[model samples]
Target: MGLGLRWYHFALWAGFILVMALMPEFVSKGTLRTMIFANFLAIFAISWDVLSGRTGYISFGHPFLIGIGAYTTAILTKRFDVPVEYAIPAAIAMTMVGGTIMFLPALRIKGSYFALVSLAFMELIYQLVQVIRPDLTGGTRGMSGIVTLTRGAANGYYLSFSLMIIVALSMWLLMRTRLGTALSAIAMNEESVKGSGLSPTKLKLFAFMTSAFVAGLGGAFYVHYLGSIAPRALFDINFVFTIIVATLIGGASTIVGPMFGAFFLTFLLEYLRPFLPGAERYLIYGAIALLLYMYQPKGLYHIFMSQLDRFKKSGDDD
Candidate 1:
């Protein structure tokens, strides 16, 4: 359960934070806003990576967990007049409970079956919110004018980036521990993990809970940042696709990969806006993501590391 961290790990993290902290001085406000989305997207992407990416769970209904957090906080803050501090924690707790419920299906099903069940859960919740209690849930139209956490783009960017970094660093350290190795083992071979005397059930539960925790935190903060929530938007398949694609395209099992992937995808879409300016922009974005994933299935992180290693070897030869 030791961290197993190296000196370079801390150095690299410090360098990245320093660079990002100085970005506002160099970038425009519009770019700062774009970065804010990237930050939150990174958080969601990491959450997915922790569960599906690590455990081979392949959650098609991750939006189910995220929506729980978002809707929970939204209702608590708007309908009940709950403080943001209290509401966010409640949202996270509710999400973990939702995650635990989702785990029940995993006990009997897996692979595509498990994925389908997760998707069903997402759809079920989507329909429930609209029909069950429109007054508090905001129904189909959704809720707006919710309390915002930050005042402007710069502040929003800082707050989001800080949260993303904290999550990334924490997850990184956690995954470096024996529990992380156990979860990854479950992804590779549940039977083997069982043979080794580790309980696959408990490992899967840990992964689910961890994923839900991060998803809740991200979803809660994301709604506050936008000061709104919509059922369609929160539970959209496109949103789920973006999150999964970001994780895979960035490199799944590794945390830093998803974070970088989120930024890459966000900026790519932002730069494509002037040229495409419509939903069609996603077509080009998807094409590029496909090409990059095909080129380096291990993701940009692995590609970068491989190149760095090659350079060092070449210098040694010289």
Candidate 2:
């Protein structure tokens, strides 16, 4: 059943990708810009899913890891005048270091306590970025005119879309492996995984490191795409909320779910602009999200699978 379902999912994704590849032909340039943001959001959301969603680590400070990557590359390229090619990899390395720092807390903390610690880490970075090195970090204003990896809307769209697809496909394949099952097992019960002769610590370290790598890669590339970065933008609670919400609403622990969530939330926000056009729109959006999450905590993925099962069963019965 799992194998059959996997094939079905794979085919569906293939078709979806074909459609997405052709989307630029139909949509306006502004919509393509929005898609670029959605792609990055999906990357960050998927990165969060690998650790928090799969392992049940519930990291609220994921942006901290992402910020470390973004800032590392930003400072390296902006101040030191390093080439983006070298700086991007350095940024990813910095995020790994930051992830290791986070892993230390994960050793002692779990659940809500762990979440609080992550949040604190994010807040710490937020403050430090503003105060500690105003000269290099650019203080509150942040560095601008950093760099662009591509020119024009179509090129930018393709760059982001290709990155998103590669990350999504890579993560999707990884999660299908035994390691993925083991990590998910850790989420269910760490003690059980240990009793089964696998070190939970090692599995978790792997998860954290991998998660940080993707987040960092996405953050670094995203910065270059925008050619700018700010402390507030990188470390914002709202930003964290968006990543988490996208993952949850689309279905946590499922790579495709977060991508769907990113696009869904992005388009929803765009659709609402004509109606609400202000902060209050989010109030409505939040209410809908809260209700859906409470009703189906597993998210739209489960809902989708359930419906598909029903359809198949009905066909079999007929």
Candidate 3:
């Protein structure tokens, strides 16, 4: 059964890679640019999934970790003239360390209180970025003139797409392990995991660190790709909403679900832009999200899985 599961997983990803590889031949440059954003968004959403979706930790402040990565790399490369190669790795490590520190409060708190603490962390960072070390942070204007990883839509698309696929595949594999089961078990009931003699503290710490690592990696790479960083953009609640909603709408607990959700949300928003052309579009989008979330909190992935099951059953009968 394990072998079969591995085969199924490998086949799905292999097919996805084949399709992504071929997509450039048929799509326009403009569409490819949008797809690149989708890829980055998917990576970030998957990062969120490792902890919040899997362990029920519900981090409202993941942007805090992401910001740490972006800011660290940006500050190092811009102010210190550190090489990009070393700075990016340092950024990721900093994000994990910062995340572990932030998560210390969650060790003592749970549920709503934990969520609030995370939210506060994001706000705190936002304020600090504006006031602290205006020279290094570039003040309210933030940093521009940063280096981009690739030029043109095609190269950018492939880079982001490859990164997203690698991150998603690796995360999917991790979640299939016993550690994954233990994390999920803690999500279901922390007390129960403790009763089983497995420390929930240790498991939660593992989940937070893993989530931070992914978020940091995605965030650091993203800043370099865009070649810019700003506090308002990185630390916004709307950004948080998009990440969380994408994960939830895609089917929170599964890695693939958030990837699906990110693409779907990206395309949906892009399609709406021409029609509404303003902030009002978000109102409509938010409404749809709320309605769907209220009705089927499990998300589109759950619906897709159910439909697939029904189709398989009908085919078997025939």
Candidate 4:
């Protein structure tokens, strides 16, 4: 069943895209801008899900990979005068290489130790970018006036939305393959996977690379979208917290879950702006997220599936 595909899956995805594509027509430009952020967040959340969510690795420093991509492109475009077309691809490659180098060592450990090592990697990069080459990295202040992919809220929303959909669809398809199952099995029981004659190391390497690819893609595009990059903003704990929370709240081990979770978290924050227009909004936002997570640890995805199943069963009874 892991490899199986159903008509309803395609139908559901199509319906969702249709609805989202129509959003620009009805919502205000400010709301569209907010959605652009949501689209990017979804991309980041999905990247996190691919590695930590599926493999049980639980990386606390995903932004480390993201920062690599952002900095690579920013430096290339701003300092070296490289064309964006070349710079973005270079950014992705650099991020993958960086992620592999940083994460390969930590793979030897497990659980909280692995998490700490990843966090350390993030902190390491954070300090390195600021001190190693201030001119290239723009030091702590970061680089601005980077190339932007689109203009106007409407155009930005479409670009971001398109990228988010492509990433979501690609990942959803990938996770249905045999390799995905192997990676997932590693999460459930590493020893058992080894016993089954699969090399857990190779599987993990593949998963890590895949996650880094997505992170790099998202990070590169994200910086381009914003036309700037700051070390503090990219490497901050709050940023890490948001990405992990969105993935968990949406449902781990599922692609669509994180996408919806990103939108949900973004909109929730926007909705609270009027009432608590400061840091206080985060308090209430975090509380609501905590409550939802507590009530449905499996995430909104499971709740939705349960309701669908229940409705099907009721129709059969009738």
Q: Could you say which candidate leads in lDDT?
A: 1
Once all C-alphas are superposed, what RMSD does model 3 give against the true structure?
A: 1.5
lDDT of each: 0.93, 0.90, 0.89, 0.91
lDDT of 4 by residue, 104-123 (tens): 87558989889898999899
Task: Check candidate 1 and list the clashing pairs.
Answer: none
- Assess every candidate by TM-score: 0.97, 0.95, 0.96, 0.97
Give me the displacement of residue 316 in model 1, in angstroms. Answer: 4.1
Per-residue error at 283 for model 3, in Å? 1.6
- Backbone N/Cα/C clashes per model: 0, 0, 0, 0
Off by over 4 Å in 2: 1-7
For model 2, how does the per-residue alpha-carbon lDDT over 42-112 read when each residue is reduced to its tens digit? 99999999999999999899999999888889899989999999999999999999998998988878999
> Which TM-score value belongs to model 4?
0.97
**Residue pairs in candidate 4 whose N, alpha carbon or C atoms collide under 3 angstroms:** none
lDDT at position 173, candidate 4? 92
The best-first sequence of candidates by lDDT reads 1, 4, 2, 3
Q: List the residue pairs that clash in candidate 2.
A: none
Candidate 2, residue 120: how far the Cα is off, in Å: 0.8
Clashing pairs in 3: none
lDDT (Cα, tens digit) per residue for candidate 3, span 122-215: 9998889889999999878889988778898899999999989999988888888788888889889999999999999888888888888988
Regions of candidate 4 where Cα sits further than 4 Å from its true position: none
